[model samples]
Target chain A: MADARDAEIDDLINNLDRDYDFHPGGKDNAGYGRDQADNKQQDLQKLLNLWIAERTCPDILPYDEELISTLTDRLRAQVEFIEMTTTDPEAASQSKLKILLVESELERIKFLIRGYVRARMHKIDKYYLHLSTQDTDTKRKLSDAEQRFVLRRATQLKRFYDQRFLSSFPQALQRLDDNSPILPMVDTPDLNEFVFVRVLQDVPGEVVLSNDDSVDLQKGNIYVLPYKAIRKFLRVGEVELV
Target chain B: MALPLKQIGTFLPSEISFLAENTSVSIVPRQALDVLELIGLNLPAMRPMRRVEVPLWVAIILKKQSRCNIIAPTWLSEDSLKAAYEAEASNMTRFSNKLPWEWIEVGELVLTSAPDDLACPPHIIRNLLRDIREIRQAKVRAGLKSLDPTYMQIDNVGAMELNEIRQFVTMTMNELRVLQNGRAEEEAEEEVEQYPGEDSDLEDTLETTEYSIPRDSSNFDDSLRSRSRSAAPLGERRPTSRAPAYEDDEGDEEEDLEMDESYLHTVKDNSSGQR
Candidate 1:
């Protein structure tokens, strides 16, 4: 019975123009145009409902029913608009408006279908991997499952690496200055020069003045003392120059 | 009026004097001399105007230029120019054919710079002949049929053969170089004759840079050598299928054993020794 009805519908669709027109010549027949338009609308609604039922999962499945509904509603609205505009000659005068509405409705449907297909494919891949993991003991079974996992992971890592290294590194490196010092404290001399000078400490004073009492500085291994006494060294060119 | 001797070197004074003595003429200023020079006549030559008879055709062409009043007779004509061009071309073609073969080869080397562009450079030609003969002997020992007569003919001497193509190119380049060194009028004619058909082929193969054989040509050499090698061994393997079959149940168990037995049989038969 359903097949018979579908055949009938197909026949009507195939000869839609001939059945809907009044005559070959231009003439007005409001009743005939309304009936034909109503029949087309019914056929379109039936087709859209069948497509939605076949493609969309039930509420239990993780699928976007709201997006699907929105797309269907927009498509239904366009069908209604096309029917209304074509039935009345006066309303059909805005050809550009009709075209714009039809185009926008098609674009929306295309975007929704693309999104749905991408999401559905990703879900199917995940489901296949899960099922393959369960049969781990068989030799061929494990290898096939592992190969699938490797391919999926490789695709994911390739995308991540491209985004991280190839796209972002150039701009990040361009923002740095060459002269900016990385460690300023270690490079400054004031902190180290005073500490080196403090290292030369004298023992308890044995009146450590003696001849020409300038402060008697101890000679560390790095420092050397001349053979002349301190006061003689102070006198005008008296000590041997070393 | 004859040009003053002082102005002879500064302009086309000889042509001017001849035009002045021979025809009705006008003197164009130095500024219009450039325009006159472009039209293949020197302006400084025309002076002391008088009427002379030019052909109807020459007068009609000159009348359209708007620069000068048409003299009845003009010295230049389209037919005379075309005849001069053809005469010059014939002289160059005659000269090119008489050039020495060595000089032709040298000229070809300068043009193409490819060893294969000149009769395989004599040494390669000798080697190719020897190799083809050796390959033929091997084919006989292997009981293979002689190569097709057409291929042999092409190999010996044909247009597409390497050596023949080389000789053809050498001859062509020698002709071109001769044409290049000919008189200017001859050179112009030669350019028209040589460029239209031959230049496109030469441009495709003979790049201006030094020629080196493409690295991928090793594959061509490999294919040639392998084909020669395959032709020799094919005869020895033909009688192998005639061996008597022995039904042994154990033979089915080992594939490698069957291969080894057949290989040994082939070796023993070829080596003329008992297995």
Candidate 2:
């Protein structure tokens, strides 16, 4: 965190005397003015994308904490820097106005990030059971730290369930197979995996399921099939995933 | 099995499982039949006892006409289903694949649609299917309470059941998440209230966050008036924007007067007003 602040200070100190020749209005990626705005915009865009992914794909791991923390810290430092420059009597009036614009933009982005994280935290806490039981492919959506956290939480949950439900049940109701590890017991629902597909056009062709059973698709029928099975048809607009 | 899916005002898991059940049935024509036109396919003209594939609905129709007999799938039987049910019951901590994915739905479909074809009485088969459903529902309910990941197999579970449980699990999780974030119940309520008025495009850009600025008095008044207009024609057409700020005590009296004026205007406009 201290290193980040020092880097920002170094950037400001080194560039203070350098006259920028590039125009802000021109589509010049190399321009100092354009690059600063573009980088900030990109950061905001990435944050938005992370939030959207978290909401739409419940099975996928939630956004990493480090990303949010890093963004928050960067924005805070930028805000402080802008405040110092804006109030400085030596600072040029035009540059101060530009700094103010940048400050407002940063605040807007931070507001959005804060709201997005809050909303996602709600979902993460709510669907921990389903999320924890997710396969490696889905779990990989989370950061290393989040993955470890979920594993530990899942272990704690397994122990809690075993003590509360399994152990208390009669001997006959207990599991016959003892081979499989109890913690992180696999088989929870992948909430985002299925599609409520409506058969828009008649398909005389058969769909082979995971269990190798063949199903004949017909018009005006709705079925919740696995997304992978009908993704091709969805792409061609033959089926609508409602 | 986990507890039966709660009444989430959506399709039950059983109904989803029922819809998801394979509807295609293998049938054999008892006599030479011309079914090309009836079946909507270029199925070769069947000779006596020739096997033909058709949907369950088509099979039922053909059987009703005495043109063909339904060939029950290998999975449909009293003994096999009983064994499957037993396996599911015995294995409380693991998902059982002893029965086909749509066992309960398929059994009910066959028994209800073509009972006479079965070796046993329809009622007997119906009772057996009911028993299996009850046990399965009980299992689902238990799974919910225990958060039984093993018993809560979404793929093997029916759509109705999955959707029902999904709503509950998701809702519970969201509540916990909100609590962890230090949000109160009213904040959650306010968020939900804002959803319908929110733009779909903005929702995407905001990542489903309620980032749109909170409604101010003017916008709130406009919405309230619009809602009231749609709900009742007798409501006043007062210019809500011109109304004094709602915080003023006198503003309340002016609002009441407007309502009264509108009521009186309605009565005056109707010359032959009844009652």
Candidate 3:
């Protein structure tokens, strides 16, 4: 039931949105229905941004639970759609061509997911010690699965070190989280690491680099700054790491 | 095993090119094709001679099959490229913000895949892009000398250019931040003096991220987490129209079944003919 092909296909593919019930007042937005195309496009862009951010940011960002779950559901539907479309005998040549397009897009999204998750896993592996001992609120930033993985990884890595070399060291030396005055054993992301950020909105106030120097954060301008200096801006969506 | 040390925190040139392919370009399909119900976005039906927007990757596929002509983005036109080249060349101290973020990747892709579709000769566009890239790269190299520990403002830097300078700029700035911090610490100034921007907001955000860093072992060790208040907002909505219909997939499945039977009949005829 459709007035045009665009509307028809929009309904066909976007039924998953309704199934998820995430768009609580699905109809509240006057034309939220037809905007599926835009939503999907935006979601893709959001995923790309996340993948880039995860790769470049010094600290592990909060896990995007809602976005990932919605996308995972859509990926499943498309996979099923592909299975149905490829087997249909009508539009044999046409369907084959369409299948190619579908498959290509499917692979693109798959690549994005793999890149995003892999980057997160790599960070988790790097910072497990810090993550394991951090406050609960800090650990909650990771997905539940990641939380489990961090614990197991941190425990196993510590055990391995103990078996390999720590057993020979003094009791005090065996501790991984030794907050030594000079140097600590735990590895943490360098918050002071420099990152390139593309400003999304004008910063509320001038950013003070020090007592004397201040830089205006204008929209649509890219700046290279320590992740710590712009961390709040990145969170408030005033800027994004390029 | 760990990721390759060098590859860590870096993207290969080819990867950037691949990412660029997702951006849309205009195309006129020579042969009509049914709609593609893709996972990411639903592409509308393509009709002959009716120009439509499609992802660059799709345009490349259609162009390779001789089924469509890619409409090069206006910026890739000879006049635009020439203008951009001149603007960039004249601005020795700064990079003119003329090109798109994906300019380098998109320009190369279109030139290679559908050169015949461009308004001017491919070489002209290629040469212009090359000239612009050269001037901008030189500027990028020179800009490193002025890099401040606080921030490096280089507008209109191409994706590829950013990657090339990424390792060097990040390392140098990081070292500078540490040295500056050490000096600031010796002065016995509070940590708030070290960071710029809204102090309260910065502290609020730091509480959420729960950082693990600093000192670099030449020396580093500190925890800077606090009470959390706000979570960052999610993706915002864009303007779109129409009251959505609440149709179930039950109808689509029926339509699929009918098409299936009809297609099976055609398949039988073809198989019979072959036999």
- Model 2: per-residue Cα lDDT over A36-113, one tens digit each: 544644565456545433433333344557667767777776677677777886765645433633454465556557
Q: Which stretches of candidate 2 lie over 4 Å from their true place?
A: A1-242, B1-22, B34-45, B146-155, B163-166, B173-275
Q: Which should have the higher DockQ, number 2 or number 3? A: 3
Q: Mind giving the per-residue lDDT tens digits that candidate 2 earns over B1-275?
A: 01112321233454344333325677887766442311012233567787877556456656766767787666566776677678768966544555554565666667766778876677866776677667777877776675311112233454344555655654443333323222233332343343221123322422322233222323444444333222222211111111233223323233234434444454444322321
Tens-digit lDDT string for candidate 3 (B1-275): 23444545777788789889989999999999876667667787899999999999999999998899999998999888888888888879888877999999999999999999998899989998888888888898789888877777888888888988888888677655555554554355355333321213323333322233332233432322210000000000000110122122213333224233333443454345435
lDDT accuracy of residue B37 in candidate 3: 61
lDDT of each: 0.31, 0.49, 0.73
Q: Which regions of candidate 3 are displaced past 4 Å?
A: A1-33, A90-92, A210-212, B182-275
Comparing 1 with 3 on DockQ, the higher-scoring candidate is: 3
Q: Score candidate 3 by DockQ.
A: 0.19
Docking class of 2: incorrect
DockQ scores of all models, one per candidate: 0.00, 0.01, 0.19
Could you give the TM-score of chain B for each candidate, in order? 0.14, 0.53, 0.66
lDDT of 1 by residue, A33-92 (tens): 446455543443333322222122211122335545555665676667667768888767
Candidate 1 wrongly placed segments (more than 4 Å): A1-61, A129-242, B1-275
For A1-242, candidate 3 gives per-residue lDDT tens digits of 44698887889778976655545664544355458878888888899999889888989999999899989898898888888876776755567777777778888898888888888888887778889988988787999999998899888988999999989976745666653222334566767688889999999788876446778888988888778779999998899988
Best by DockQ: 3
